[model samples]
Target: MDSGDVDFAHTDEAARKRRDKAVGLARYVWDRGIGGPELLALPDDRLRKLARAAGANPPSTRETWSVVAEMLDEKSRWAAVHPDDPRAVPAHADEKIMWVKPPLPPWPSR
Candidate 1:
């Protein structure tokens, strides 16, 4: 096979690996109920190490970071409803912003 074909195959394999890892991580988080704040609080190096230990095959550094961010978001939303949960609300003020605009009715008021 040509070098281009070889590279494509390798890329495909990597993508599949990443997808598998993400799914696994998602399942673990779902089953364990480990809050996202805990994950976000981890240092980048530490997070990467945890991912490796968790058997994640992140396709790229960017993707790895994104996964961490997603975990945090999920944890935050869950915690918001679970008062006893320890996960703090997301720190980003913008993320917490809720518009006060009135909701439109299904039909115009007569």
Candidate 2:
């Protein structure tokens, strides 16, 4: 991905920091034998406690779930980009597409 493609000026530092923290929390859970499925299976109260235990401020049930969902989304994007890696599991191929050049500037009309 080209850095130039992004509008860094408009980027939200706060949101990025939050997401980064969430990713770290999600990773911590996974490393501790609690991946997405296990996390989702835990009761709501337990999930809130889990978030607090991870040092994340008292997040609501919805916020805790969002962390899992966001982490899963990031994971899927990673798998899509690294299909050949042994650790990458295949997600639904329907929504995943490998890179393709933009259709614009239509390959020099010959």
Candidate 3:
């Protein structure tokens, strides 16, 4: 293959990796019940901050839902273009974002 072809392949793989990460993160936020009309009302700056805090690129559009949709759509497009590629959602994705509370200390022994 030509050097150009090799460069293109590397670029495509990087894009795929980025899309996969965004999709996982979007799902994590969705699982946490973090979206709705209230979030939509947030100013663009705040929305961008929230996205950044969630480890996502700041949305190009003002709507947070659009950010989630954009992330998901990119993954879907990749899957469509590479039908043989394994497209499984990462197992236990929520575990990455879960904030498990520490259990109370065992009751004092009598």
Candidate 4:
């Protein structure tokens, strides 16, 4: 079926089966430490092969890399500051600064 023509509806039994499958896949991945960057960096075809070997469908390599990059960025940011440093802590003191855009004057009429 075409992407737009695919049906999203599922019966109760089908939903339960899907949920069970997902849980099983999650357990398998967790046990194998599948979230690590080495696995995340594998090519899409290779990832698919790995996932099939693990009995789960693999997502696109781009999606996997995006997730890996986000996790690494977060970890790096956290590691940059000392735990006891007050200045290292993120503050909400200027949350409004991002939304405060400068006003522009009206354009002259032709």
Each model's lDDT: 0.52, 0.57, 0.54, 0.47
Q: Say which prediction, candidate 3 or candidate 4, comes out ahead on lDDT.
A: 3
lDDT of 1 at 106: 94
lDDT tens per residue, model 4, 21-77: 445443444334343354455566765655575576664335443444455344436
Top candidate by TM-score: 2
Rank ordering of all candidates by TM-score, starting from the highest: 2, 1, 3, 4
Tens digits of per-residue lDDT for model 3, 36-107: 333455567765665676777764544335556565555556646886754534334454333322348999
Q: Weakest 10 consecutive residues, lDDT, candidate 1?
A: 93-102
The CA lDDT at 100 in model 3 is 28
Clashes of 1: 0
The parts of candidate 1 lying over 4 Å away from their true place are 1-10, 32-41, 56-60, 68-110
Compute the lDDT of residue 82 as modeled in candidate 1.
Answer: 88
Stretches > 4 Å off in candidate 4: 1-9, 36-47, 56-110
Least lDDT summed over 10 consecutive residues: which range in candidate 3? 93-102
What are the root-mean-square deviations of the candidates from the true structure over C-alphas? 11.9, 16.6, 13.9, 15.8
Q: What is the lDDT of residue 102 in candidate 4?
A: 34
TM-score of 4: 0.32
TM-score quality measure for candidate 2: 0.44
TM-score of each: 0.39, 0.44, 0.35, 0.32
**Which has the better TM-score: candidate 3, or candidate 4?**
3
Model 2 C-alpha lDDT per residue in residues 1-110, reported as the tens digit of each score:
58669764336874575576677666555434344555566667766666676687644435546766568657757767997985465332231222111236758768
Which candidate achieves the best lDDT against the true structure?
A: 2
Residue pairs that clash (backbone atoms under 3 angstroms), model 3: none
Clashing residue pairs in candidate 2 (N, C-alpha, C atoms within 3 angstroms): none
